[model samples]
Structures are given as structure tokens and as C-alpha cells.
Target chain A: MSLILKAFPLGFLINHDLSEEENVSRDLRFERENLCLIKIATNLRLEDVNYLMENLGIPYKYKNDNYFLNNGLCVHWESYQGHYSVFISANEKTLFEKTKRYVDLIKQGELLFKNFDIMLKRNTRDVNSKEIFYYCYKTNFRTRLDVLEALKKHQMENILSNTENEIRFKYNNKNYKFKRNNKKEMFYIELEQKISLVNIGSGKKSLIVKNLKTNYTNMDALLKTLTERGAFSVHSDKYNIYCEMSGMQFLFSRNNTRGQYFLSVDRVSDEELCTNILKELDEEYGLNIQDIVYKKIMERIKDKNMRIESEEVQDDNSIVLTIDLG
Target chain B: MGKLKIKLLPDGTIEMETKGIKGKKCLDYAKVLEQLADAKTEKISKTDEYYQNSYLELDESQHLSDN
Candidate 1:
């Protein structure tokens, strides 16, 4: 029998502590309150991520399935969703304090957490995308004719005469089409790529671009994507009418087979933008501006409500809320 | 029939507009929807509907009652 003398790699074993080392493969496990913890305003490397997680004295696992972070704050990283978001449960208000500490550490000397509510964009593509500004409003247009009349009254400039049956528009190299799905609801799809063009007045290269398409090619997939991405939908409807004018768009929707009248302005970025656009739209259509419906609907909906038409976060940049009065 | 319209914007703004109806009657039926959505009364436009005193809505000569 040959005896082999071997020195144990004690240092290697000590340094690679299984508990301390990040389980980059383990599916993260944590109860998400949908509350953001720390916003990584800038790009960071894996080492920096490790350093931050270690100093926080939290058990965090970031891998393929999920990113679970726990520092007595229930922190989790939302990286797979296009942007990197660190979400923490605001339970017992511990998230606020932890967020403050995180911001302080990241800033070191610069401004951080200026508006913690904003959730500033990072590479987190799923949420921070500025592409699709999906929004809806509660309108009282009884029929398609009523909507057309309002559009004309509001001076929707250069609208297509609709000599053709299919809804189509061409601006620059981009072509947008509206097609009815099996559910009979309209889906906006992009049919072309890019082409540079001269602005009629300035002769400058310009693209009259509007981001309207969701990640999916079909409406059903889009609904699924939205739900998985944590979008809240309120209600469902039977029929819908859509139109576009200049930088603005409209969707008149209904739940019943007969006249349903809800008006929504498409593509405005925020509440202030929506308000300002509403002002211009009101002036054109003889409207008296009152309140935003999302807040009201949110208030009316119980937290446990699971209606898909009620609300959806179109992206990190936009939240689309739908409330079917029917 | 006169149309009582409730305009709900994405930013959580709601506007009520009545067409072919004059006086406060334009807002009468709208109140029900307003309450259902839990919306607050922000800016009310008279649309010549408030000042005419007469309930009849004339097609010509639009008048603004308030900003």
C-alpha cells in the first residue's frame, strides 16, 4: 500500500465559504412588495455588485432565475427585466432607511436619491425603455362618429382620408399598421425599418418616429408579457377604435357590443405631460379637464384585484391603466 | 340627446365636457360617473352653457364663460 501525503488546501476552503459566496445559479426567493430599494443610476460591474452586496451584510443571490437580496429589508435585484432595479419591501418602513444607506454609499460625494420615486433608467431594458409610451384615459365618446367629430373639432392635422380599408400610415421609412386580432381588438405593429428623410421645411434628416409596438407580435402575447412584467390591468371590453394625429394618438374603447365611450391619449410621458397635452386636446375639442383616471381607479381597486384591463406598466417609463366602467 | 363626456387621461386627469346641452344640466348625469371613478372636480368650463341663462343651445356664436 502506498501512502500519499497531501497538504489540505485550508486557505482555499476558508476563502470559498459556500454561504458567503454568491449563489449565482440559485433562483432568488423573496416576497416582493414592488418597492424599489436602490436605483443603480449608472453602470456597474459584477465586482462592484459583489462589493455592494457584501458591505450591506445581506444574504443576496443573483443568478438566472431570480435575484434575492435580504438585509432585513427584503431587497432583490430586478436585472432580467431590461434594467437593473433593486427592490426592497417597505415593510415596517425599513426599506427607506436601507435605501438611504445605499444611496449614501453609492454617491460617496455626488447626488444620489434626488427623487427616489423616479426609479431613474439604467440598462434595465424591460422597464426603463423609452420606446413605448402606452397610456389610456376615460373618455365619453359614444360612437366612432362622435370620436371623428371630436378629432375634426380638435384640428387633428393631416389625417388620412381613409380611402383604404386597412388602417395604415407612412412617415419617413417607418410604416405602422393596425390589424384586428382574434379578440377583435386592434394591435399596432411596425412593418418597416429605418430611412433618413428631409424635413419639408428645414431639409434636415428627420424620422417621425413613434414607439407603439409591444415586445410581442400578437395581442395575446403582449397581454401575457405585460402581466408577467407586473402590469396591472383593470377591465375588459368588446370593441375598440383607434386613431393618430401628429404627435398624439387616441383609442376610443367600449366593453359592450354597443356604444362604449372611453377616451385615451397615447404616448404622453408623465402626468404633467398628459395634463399639458390634455389642455391642448381640450382646447381643440371643447373639453373641461378634470382629473386623471389612474389614480382614481387605483383608489377604487382593492390591492388584491387582478383584472388585466385595470392597469399595466407598459415599460419602466410608462404605466397604462385601463378601467372598464362596464 | 346631449352628450355628457368624461375625459380620463393617462396622467390621472379627468375632464367633463357636455355637447348640445346647456346650463348645469350638462353636468347632472356626469356626476354619477365622476363619483364612480373617485375623481375630483378640477377645472369646469362653462362653454357658453353657464351664462346663457336660457337652456336653448345655439349653433352659431360660441361663447366662453370661464377659464
Candidate 2:
């Protein structure tokens, strides 16, 4: 006689509802294959299997020489065996039935998920919970695009040259245009504000600036110091309108019977801020500031002294500094 | 004659062995298989025969006279 194994829901079994004919049929079939089937659930701990078997009154059996220890499920059985085989064969009909039950449970479990969703919604009502807004507010600084728009709106031109190498912005009032050579470098234009500045260059030496407009002579002395050390300007504007030397810029504006000046250096130090005002200037104003500064400083030194000697040496960090003595 | 052997484990790991080949020639022989499998060489062993073959000198006089 052919045995028809009625498959009952595992939920029905857990609930102790075995009164139906379907439950009786499923129970008989499950009992027959329980030992062999439990072996397939080895990843489920021994304690869990023992608890399940004891509760269901099923006996446990172990078999040696089973290759299933290394390779999981290597048994071949008939697909339509009214009862599930000793092996956990993922046949189409079995998978379809199991998947249907799983989907039903998942649908039923949506009530719990809905409660979780309500809790999350209630928690997010607090202002502190708005983390996304906080992050956005913290990072809402003016971008390059914003700066460019602002510069355009201000109508700052003439000194502003748009090129791939650098972006030049001329402060019309200050009579000096700031050039940003590299992306990380920032050149600021303070119309009437006095800013302290310090710059550490080649040998980690600092150039001190107290007041940018007032300390023009001190700034020139620093430039001369840099020139004597061989780090001179490769470019200079006609009439020394602006000095671009050694990757730095110095801007001088012609006034009535005099000249007002601004010093721009890449970066300044705390000590330099105490002594002088340093403005960072960029090269590429279509003038070789380094050569101009070098020649000007050399001439001044030669005029003061009988002989001048200069030598350049590259340090371990590969920075070349030329030293000049008068 | 030396032959190379390659075995694949259940977890997709591969073990390669060079059989009959002497000295570092085993490495040369297994290169193709290693390339095909994209295997990292975890360990390597040289047999006693590998060292013996290195010291074995050919009978040069016999070959010279024959030539």
C-alpha cells in the first residue's frame, strides 16, 4: 500500500493541534524520517535537536562513513515520494510549499514591523534626531563655485584672468589682484583691515610681518633676505608694480608722490604675525618675479659690499636654498 | 617524466602538486595550472631527488666522441 504523508504546518505542530487527519498523516511521515532529517540540521546545535526530539518524542540516530559531514546533502531520491526523503532534497514542490508558508509568516509578521516603523517615526520627531540637517549645516561653507559667483557679482576684473593654471582676482580698491596657483592655496584681500602674517619657507624659516601697509620696508627686507638666500623672484612687473618671485607675490600700488604696498605669502606663522604683515602672492602674473628679485637684491648687495658670494645646496628633504653673502 | 596534479577542495580552495619533476622545474611545470586557477602559492616543498639531480653530471666525453 502506498503511504501518503500529509504535510502539516510546523506552526500547527508547535501549537499541539494534532486532531486533524492531515496532522495525523504528517506526524507519521515525520516520525519515520525524523532521525535522518535531523542529521541534515547539524548546523542547528545538538542541544536544540535534543530539545526538539524530546518534545516530539522522536529518537536520535547517528551514522558513520557519511560524506555529508564534509559535503552537505549528496543523496538522490525520488521527487514525488508522498513523504519527504531522509535527505533534505530541495525539490520544486517542497520548495514551493515551504516558500508559500514562509511568505505567509512574513506577511503576518508585518504587524510587528509596523509597530517598529511607528516607534522610529515617533523617535525622529525630536530636533536632535535630525542628524542629516546637522551634517548639512556643518558643511555649508562657501564652495569654489560660490566664491566664483561672488567674484563675478562684485565685477572684479582686469586682474582676473581665467586660465587652467590659476584664477586671478583683482581687488579693485586695493589695486592688487590675488592669484590662487594651487587649489589648496588661499589668497585673501583685506581692503582696509590690518592682518598680521608669518611665513615659513624652504628651510622652515619664518618671515614676520606686523602691518602690511606700514611695514613695506620690513617686507622688502624679508624679500631681500629671501633673494640673498637664492630664492628670488622669477617675475616682476614693469616699475616693480608687483613682484612674483620664488612662487610668492608682492603687490605695490602707486599713490600720489608715494606707493602703498601689500605683501602676499603662501602661509604665515604665529611669530611672523607679531613682527610683520605677510600677504601670500602667486606667480604667473606674466612676469618673472624670481629673476627680478634676485637681480635687484644682488645689485643692492654688490653696491654695499666689494664682493658677494652665493652657493646652493639641496637638503635631505630635497629643498635647494642658495646662500648669498655681501 | 614529471606531471602536475591539481585538486579542488569542497570550499573552492585548490591544492596543486607537481609529481615526478625534480628541482625548481616543478614550479615551472605548475605555473600554467596556477595561472588558470588564480591560486596563491601557500607552501612549497622540494624533494630529495631535486638536490640529487642538481649534482648529477652528464657523461660529456661520450657525447663529444659521438659528435
Give the alpha carbon lDDT tens digit for every residue of A1-326 in model 1. 01011211111111222223333222111101111222232233444444555554445444542334333334445453343444333223346455743212222111222222223232211222223211111122233333334334434344352522233444332343322233233222222322111111111112333332111112232233233333332233345445433223445455544332455654432334335544554342321211234454456545424232434444332344443322
Give the runs in model 1 whose Cα sits over 4 Å from its true position.
Answer: A1-326, B54-67
TM-score of each: 0.21, 0.17
Q: What is the lDDT of residue A225 in candidate 2?
A: 42
Deviation (Å) of A141 in candidate 2: 43
Query: Which is the leading candidate under DockQ?
Result: 1
Count of backbone collisions in candidate 1: 29
Docking class of 1: incorrect
Candidate 2 residues A183-212, lDDT tens each? 564432212211211221222333433325
The TM-score that candidate 2 achieves is 0.17
Ten-residue stretch with the least lDDT total in model 2 chain A:
A130-139
CA lDDT of A181 in candidate 1? 30
Name the regions of candidate 2 deviating beyond 4 angstroms: A1-326, B57-67
